[model samples]
Target: MQYIYAMMFALEEINNSSTLLPGVKLGHHIHDSCSLPAWALQAALSLVGGDMPSCNSAAKYEEEKGIGASKGDQPVPLIIGGCNSVTAQIVSRLLVPLSLPLVSYTASTPSLSDKQQFPNFFRTMASDVYQARAIAQLAIKFKWTWVGAVVANNDYGLMALKVFQEGIQRAGVCLAFVETLQRENIVSDARRAALAIQASTAKVILIVAWYTDVMELFLQLDKLNVTDRQFLASEAWSTSSDLRQSTFSHKVASGVLGVAIRSSTLPGFDTYIHNLNPLLRPNDHFLKEFWEKEFGCSPGIATASPFASLPPCNGTESLWAVNNLFTDTSQLRVTYNVYLAVYAAAHALHSLLFCPDVNSSPGHNITCSFTNQIKPIELMEQLSKVNVTTPQGEAFNFQGADITGKYDLVNWQSSPEGQVQLVLIGLVNGFDLHLNESAIQWSTGSSQVPVSICSEACPSGTRMATRKGEPICCFDCIPCADGEISNTTGSTQCVHCPSEFWSNAERTACIPRQLDFLSFNETLGITLTAVAVSGVTVTIAVFVVFLYYRQTPMVRANNSELSFLLLLSIKLCFLCSLVFIGRPSAWSCRFQQAAFGISFVLCVSCLQVKTIVVLAAFRSARPGAEALMRWFGPGQQRGSVCFFTSIQVSHYFDNLSFTPDSVHIQWLSEVYTYYISY
Candidate 1:
């Protein structure tokens, strides 16, 4: 209805302009399509004269015209709209064979771009391809991986669904379910769609339907108390006044995010609506119906007896009391399309009539001559090349059969007073999509963006474990393994640490491993160092005691030299343990094991020599070992000790020559026992 008003408004502007098509007046017979394809077809049939008489053929019609040829018969050169895709498709099919140009204000299905099927079809609205791509980008940008979809059972819904499905999948977003709402059974279908939405876990829903379809579905959603889901509306009815004006729209679609056809504010459209009266537009024909609906009254009835219950309009009723959605000039996207559609037709006709030889002229040798004829085919050819700028400075042009227009990103937000209205949040043009995230309101009524993922995001230090038979978004968070790390949230795999490194407690990063040899500050190292020092002191005390008693007869009989060597070797053995007190280094690795080996050898040798001396002394007393006693002495015991010490030192030097220069320091302390055994 807004489109019709815009079209009529443009026609009036053009008719009143003395500079445009001078002395020629443009008039139209308007039809109410009632949002039905059959009604649209009926409207098209009425324009083509309904089997009355065969009008001039295309060739005969071109030979005669009021503007450029001898005045002669001609059919209506163009038809201007059924405002939706399905209706446009029906009307295009009915009027294409008759060679009538069908200029649509809002029909935007991409299939209509095929010139072969719709050669006479043209539109002032951008194709659904742009809108679908824009919507897919929106979901991807916000990381809304899982969402539901509800579409009407018609060409617009099915085509938009297919387009958006392909686009979103390419961007890695998945739909929870694609449900359909049947206009024929709106109540049942809406209920079923609402139940599907409520049952699924998706918090976002994409609605690809007309304004009326959206209204019915939202009404059902409100009744079901399903108001928490965010809705993504297609360009078809994204900024529809009908939806905005609906009573249940606020409850159901409070936080709708959608792509709307771009529009500039039209000046004075509000004043134009407010000043309308049946008395002024007596010839409008539909004026009576408008008066009846707006004022709730009859127009022609003079007496109150016929319609006593209703208020009879005095033709001075103010439309300012009505809702601003139907009166405001803001967000006139669809109305702008209608305005452009009329201009496209008027410009094409102007080119055919008066400016045939201008830059928009067709083919070779054609010139603007008053003798050149005007026809529907010629007007269509001109419309395909029509390029002009709107009064608001918007570029108006056609790319093949599709118009190039912008899509504004809009969000339905609640004002401080709790009234819901659309706020411009972004813009989408060509392939670029930008959004202002902070300005958007979510259905959750929280400051944060509403989450629509199938599962919560895996935090850092964990990797995702995808659930079987579920969407990729549905996953479990598993901590990284002992020697691995995951530093990013939602990481698919954890990385293993290097050989000499270990994962931190949180598993978010790797750190070099601590050196493992005994250190003096540790409990075991302190205990061992204390014991080793005490043993050394005790051995020194023993050596001193033995020296102090050397002059005594029992000490003199015990072989003092052997006793001194044994005490010194025991002291060296206790000191060897001190080498293991600090972090193992090259010097400690070589010295700790060699010192222990040599000390053990010297102690054993001293014990062996003492054993021989004792046996000889006892046997000699029995009178059979006199020769054995003569050979055993302190000098022999010293020689024995020296021999064992030399052997151990030689073995240590030989093993050290064959060992690698740098050993793995972690294993050095444990190799001390092996050195002794070897």
Candidate 2:
């Protein structure tokens, strides 16, 4: 009813203005659609080609004033009706073949944007495409990976649900369940939807439905006492006053986040509504019905009136005495849309009637040369190009058949009186949503945002392993593998560490591996060093004793020179072991192996010489053994020892070319044991 008044208000404002549509008056023929697509289509057909029924005051006034009285005359050049998407679609399809234009105030289905289907359709409201994107973005911004959905079983709800699913899927959000509500079977559907909401683990639910259907669903939800889940609403029922004032508002609508159509207060609309009286327009049945319903009185003079049993209306009943949705003009969203729709149609007509001629001379006055025979096709063309600035200083123009999307993010908050209030918390322009999260109030009466995810995020040191046959949000945390690390939470995979680096105990990060070497500070190094030093000292003492006894028969017979050489070699071997004890460097790594190998070889060569000399002495008692003694003399023994030792030294130093930055402890221990056995 307010929507009708809004259109009348805009039409009245336009007709009285001399600057626009000069010396021209626009008359309207109103029809009641009853929110039915069939009725809306019938009304549209009657306006275009059928007879104008004199059922309302506006039609009678047009008839008596001869504004468009001829039987063949097309009184309505354009239409501004069909509030819902289904109605708009039906009427537009009917009007398209006849070249009629329709400017809807609130029909916002995404399918209406198809120029091929709704070529002559223009709407003041933004399409559901933008609304779906805004809702999806809001969920993603808050990291609500898992959520439930409830949509009406109609074109509007189904289309919005489809688009929303696409958007959320792209962002990796998953739905726990999707429930559809049928207006025809609202009782059963709402019960099922409520049960789905109650049983689901999702803490948030997205509801895309009309006001009445949503109201029914909320009633069921209230009966079930489902108060823990937060609901995300579409523009259709987001700011509906009926829902706000419903009995279940506190139980089911608290902490509801919604994307509402952008709205502004329409100037003079409140006064226009207050000044309405059935007596002034007695032929208008809609006004009488509104008056009776609002004042709860019988305004009809007939005895068969439905409201005859109620109190009689005095025609002086003030509309301000009662507060209702009809008179409430605080947030004029759909009303403002109606106003824009009317103005757009008027502007398009003005452009068509007073079009400037391209062939006219410069500075010549453009004439307003238009008859009442205006074609709907020409008006549609002009409407496509019409750009109008609203009274609130906002400007908009049609991109194709729809305007750019802009929405207000509203949250249902409880006032001090326990009434649900739609609080402005953010704005969405196009696909971008600017939200004030701190201002949001959750269903739990906390300032914290609600959690809605299938699984908790994997912490650092772990990677996410998705559960089979489930959504990506449902996952398990697995510890990182050895030599791998996961630095951040919710990591999908672990990264292998670099060769020189190794994973920490927690597997959260990579760190340098410990350098392996036999250091002098450890117990093993001290024990080995003490033993090596003692062996060298004992060898030196034996060498000194042998040298002191060089003149004795025992010393001469035992080959003292060879023994001294072997002692020197044994000292070299013992000192080489020290090279392996400290932190290994390039020189120590090369010299340790070479020194051990050459010293051991030299000691073995000297022992061989001593053994041969002893055998030669023992064989001297046999005949012809003197020749063997000469061959195994002191000079020969020295030559043999020197030649073999030189060969071993050269071989050991020649092959020393390998170097390493660091060595593993296990590998170093194995190499040390092998060398000791050798």
Candidate 3:
């Protein structure tokens, strides 16, 4: 979103900066394209001019009009625009014949580079052809031998497809297939597309559509259970989430592979935009808000067409520099250096206008001022040769016959966790056409893995493999299991293991969990036996005390306790706790702990009641007046304690008796107990 702001800011700055060149001081006007494709066409044609005139017999005609007089029919002769590629084509065709200079700031379709057709047209950013070659070169470096292409049927798509095809052919790779999809076609088509590509045996497929389309295509790929294929995308892939996360994540999470020009993360980009627009904010919001407030809509590539030629270099930071340089410059900078195109054409026309050439009216000085003498198409050939250097230090010379400029390539692979590991494959000097043409292997490592990236020997357990007489594919390494992690990029060994599968944190290997031993061990099993015997002793001691005090009417009436209630309640709760602790099954492991907590709480409550009753009987003189305490008496509390103790004592045995399947009731009668009394 911020990208739009920087683009608008570039146009604003170029339109605002005054050129110190001593001539007509540059005055600037702005249009709000609203970033719409249709509006972009309007802004381009409107700013650069919709029509041009014939350059034939221009000299005698200029001489009759005096200084700067030829543009009398249409006074403003300079032009720049057609931010959309279609509009640029229209404007380029319109201006090419008469040689009116036209420049586009953002329309980067490869067709505009046609020297014969768009002789007068120029652009600051690279064309799609350059981007295509860069991506194809990246694919070659990855050792991919075959590729598929998915493109729209538009001019941008066609141009991108042509250049990509050329690049792949030049790399000695095969085109597996070419499929076309519409902007609106969804998963059904994507499924068919992937299936068809799979038939081609292509490892990587390139998409020329929007990122959302790419994401949808991949989601459908997952549904097809065909995630083995790789992917390559254009500059349009930057805003894509799948690509960004895939770089450092294991590929299994999402199958995606590609090379793309990510905008440079230089801090100066924001500063550049802020200097142009003081109320700095996010790129899109600022652009939409400012353009809407000023021009009743948001601004876009079309609105800035007049000054497209000023920002020569379209780097990550150049947008900001553009906005600051041409804010109020000379007429040339204001309209994509159209005046300079005039500056160059006026000089070229010197032979025709003033020199003793076959057509010239000799010694007649037609005013060099291009305000009117030059037609929009007259400068087409000459403008192509001009090198625009903005005050912000942005420079561009679009003389390259083929695409490909400065593009970085990174080799990527996926790991088990669904993360992509982007290994720095190597930086290719794509613009270095000399090395590539100098020899088939002139590059240090051809296009894929440059020989200069690394020279160290690969560690053991991994091997080096190359693809199709070119770049290395990957360092093949064996992966360790779930308990381990890899800390280094090329490490042969796995790192620390997590605790879920280990007795200790150290993860040499996994060990089996030990089942219950209390069922067989003498010390543990016998100790439990002794504890049960102690419970019996406690029961006997309480019963003896009850008999010793039988003469007391309080003791006789109170009764020691409800033996049946104690046995029934304790047995039921103890049985449930035993079922919980006996097995490690999911049901038992999670639910048993909760059941035990409730049972223990109840047991403790009963024990507490017994102690309280005992104390109340010892202290109170009027026992009946104490209500439940005096009326029911201290004996109830004591019996509650016995009830609780009985429950707690049985729990110890229950816990120790746990096994992998004690609650295996189907086998319980046959295996868990033998010669049962009950």
Candidate 4:
């Protein structure tokens, strides 16, 4: 309906402008195709003057006006109709023999690009080849690897399906299912397609069908309460009012992803649509039906024609108060195509008459001549070279067999009041696509695009491996092997670490594997140092107590010299542990090991000497043990401690003699450095 109103507006604008087509009035015989090829074929035959008698009468009238005629009169100068590709193909075949110029607004099938087949046919929209690849690219951008497809069983659907199948497969996306919906028995076909869509595992579904067929599927999906799935729509129904105007369908179509021909504001189009007077269109049956449906009122003398249930018209209804699909200017992608198509036809006629300068053609130049002798075939040649500026100052041309145009990607998002709107989220020009993901909304009302993957993504430290006989979306995650690293999620394979580095515990990253040694700042090192210092403090306190009670009987009986030697050895043991606390240098390594061994041996030897002296004194009470008890004196006990300590000292020098380089000697072979140094 918007397209029809747009065409009417464009023609009116051209006729009212005195600068363009001076002394020439352009008129048209419009017909509704009803989206059927048969109806379109009938209209095409009528455009060539409806048979021989009508043609002869027209030719006779032209002869009476003193004009030469050739091959009888050629119908109207041009035709603009057949919005769909299927209908346009049928209508173009009939109009080709008569050499009628047919300019279509939205017929975008690639099969029509052949000049031999559709030479007289041209369109204002881009071909379907671009649209199919754009759809596949959009799915890949969102990582929607698995999807379901539903196409109408027609030429347009089949051709688009083939192109899209190749495109998606090239992008590595797998189809979960492909269903078809036919125009005849649309109700049953939509139900079956809906069942297939529901049974499939894909969360995204693509529909390549007309608006009417899509409406039927929407009805079936509504019955099943399937509102959470995502949709990828074709240009055929992506911006249709039939789906956008209904509250129920809009709810189900919320967050619908699709492509549409680019559209812009047309300044006065909204006012023109709202101010349309139905009373002035008394001869238009379609306008009457629109009035009846929009206002719930019927024309006068209405009988039982299924429209009788509507309230009778009082002849006073205002179109301004009826807000309906015709008034919406928010999505005018198709309407803009119609507007440009009309201007293209008008510009071709202006060129044929050779008008100079549309802005100043009244008095600046002589008016071009026009006669009935000029044929429609000559007008088609002019249309092929038509180049004119649109009302918005944009270029409109049909120089080539097909026009390349831009497509806008829109998402249906819900408002706070539950109304849905088409939000522009991205665009495609030629083969390049630019998407702003932040502007999109999902059916679940989430700002994030819902995940449509068949499996969870593999985490870092693991690589994805294909599962046998399954789709690409289904895969396995395997952990990286030793000496390898997988730093990214969903990595295909692991990377090997360098020789000087080693993998981290999780194997997600690598770090330098230099010789590890303990430092005083670390927790383990600090703990060990505190314990050794505490042991030294206790030993010093015990030595001071014994020195204070040197003359006491108990102190004397325990041999004061041996006790002093034992306390000194214990102090040396604690002090020697500090040599291993710092980094292993030449002096620290050699002294740490030698001092620790000698100090521990001295402590044990002094204890052994004290035990033997105590037993000898007890045995001296017997008469024969007096000499043996004398030999085990304090000097003898000291000699025994010295002899044992000397053996340890000798062993330390023995290891140093063999190695010769103190720095090369590892303190605990550098492996236990972390344990012993701390």
Top of the candidates by TM-score? 2
Q: Estimate each model's TM-score.
A: 0.68, 0.75, 0.42, 0.65
Every candidate's lDDT: 0.74, 0.80, 0.46, 0.75
After superposition, the stretches of candidate 2 with alpha carbons farther than 4 Å from their true spots are 54-74, 169-172, 296-304, 308-315, 356-368, 518-582, 586-678
Q: List, residue by residue over 463-536, the lDDT tens digit for candidate 1.
A: 99988987676789999999899999889999999877999999999999877778899899999999999999
How many steric overlaps are in each model, in order? 1, 0, 53, 0
lDDT, residue 86, candidate 1: 76
Task: For candidate 1, report its TM-score.
Answer: 0.68
Q: What TM-score does prediction 3 earn?
A: 0.42
lDDT of 4 by residue, 1-678 (tens): 666677667767877887666545555455555566786776667556643232112110100010111223433356677677887788788778888778877788888888799889888888888888899888888888888899989878888888888888876688888889988889999999888877777888889998889999999988887777889999888877669778668767678888888977787888898876656754545566777777778866433345777778897777767666678786678788878877887777766665454677454534463545467788788889987778899877774657765899888877888777777888888778888988888776788776677777789899889899988778899999988899998788999998668888898999887555567887877877887899989999999999999999999888888899899988998887676676665556677777776777787788788878878877887887978967876678778888988987887777774341443444355425423433
Lowest-sum lDDT 10-residue window in model 1: 56-65
In lDDT terms, which candidate is top?
2
Candidate 3 segments whose C-alpha is farther than 4 A from its true place: 1-39, 48-84, 94-100, 106-109, 127-129, 167-172, 184-188, 197-201, 238-269, 275-374, 378-382, 388-395, 400-404, 410-678
TM-score head-to-head 1 vs 2, winner: 2
- For model 1, the stretches where C-alpha displacement exceeds 4 angstroms are 49-75, 240-248, 296-327, 356-372, 416-418, 514-678
TM-score of model number 4: 0.65
Per-residue alpha-carbon lDDT of model 3 for 1-678, expressed as tens digits?
A: 233333333333433433312222222223445435465445445445533333211110100010121333333344434545666777667756566565554456877777777766665445776667777765676556566788765687788989877886765466666777665566666677767865655556677765556666666655555655455555555324454463222221233334444223322445544454312332333343343343333333333333333433222332333443223221111123222222333333332223233455553344344445545444444444445554445454556312234443434444467544443333334443211222221112233332212113334323333434433322344554445644444454665444334332333445554465344245665555566556655656665666677677866555345332343334445444344333366456434543544344454455456555566766667655467464555465565555656665565446544443443442344222322321
